[model samples]
Target: MDIRRWALDSDFKVTLTRPRFTDGLLLVLLIAITILSPRLLPVRSEGDTVLVRAGESVFRIPLEENGPHRVTGPLGEAVIMVRDGEAWLENTPCPLKICEAMGPVRRAGDVILCLPNRIYIRVEGREQTDAVSR
Candidate 1:
């Protein structure tokens, strides 16, 4: 029989062992899980739907008439409008008004985020082809 002995000082010591192939495989698996996790995870999405997030509140607005509407928030306000086959954030009280800068979202996958007011507006349901066309 053989034995190995190690001496320790007053300071705390940690012993680390090198990872083997199986450990590498496990790491790869974990990486894959992290990479593809969002797809596997549950998300709320429907055909041509709108998502509105304001402060601690979140809601969904369904597109119907394609017209103008106001979305109020804690920090400020925003105006959402649809015209001539395009949807857009027309006005915002935030200083930068970056949301308004993201103009004319006519298809799905478009987003208008107002950082100051903590508001997020997204357009959903247009086809991939249509998105590319614009």
Candidate 2:
């Protein structure tokens, strides 16, 4: 019988498929995983290496050391300061001080980037990981 004919039939029988137990279980499992992933999954920690990027050049420095490193890019000079296992963008020629305002980042993937200057500071190879928030 054609579906169109069945639709027009006065005594046409129609039924809806009911969800199985496995389907409900799978849905609950997916929701649990999503809720717990953040607390269970690990985040990268602060590293001993600080990478200063200037245009096509990349300079790697030890984050454990205390000092200011200078990098030059399109906008001019920018400084990265490292003190007591923390690093931040000290100064940049960019009109917006957004990069400098990021303050000290001690986590592995944390970055201080100067868009106008094309400079970036990043950390790598640390023993401890970042907190759960990130």
lDDT (C-alpha) at residue 114 in model 2? 82
Top candidate on lDDT is: 2
lDDT tens digits by residue: candidate 2, 1-134: 77666766858676547989998999999999999987775656557888888898988888788998888899888888889999888668899898888898787777777888898887776434453352
TM-score of 2: 0.60
Error of 2 at 5 (Å): 78
Note each model's CA RMSD in angstroms.
13.3, 12.0
In order, the Cα lDDT scores of the candidates are: 0.68, 0.80
Structural similarity to truth (TM-score) of each candidate: 0.51, 0.60
Residue 102 local lDDT, model 1: 79
Clashing pairs in 2: 45-129, 47-126
Query: Lowest-scoring 10 consecutive residues by lDDT in candidate 2?
Result: 125-134
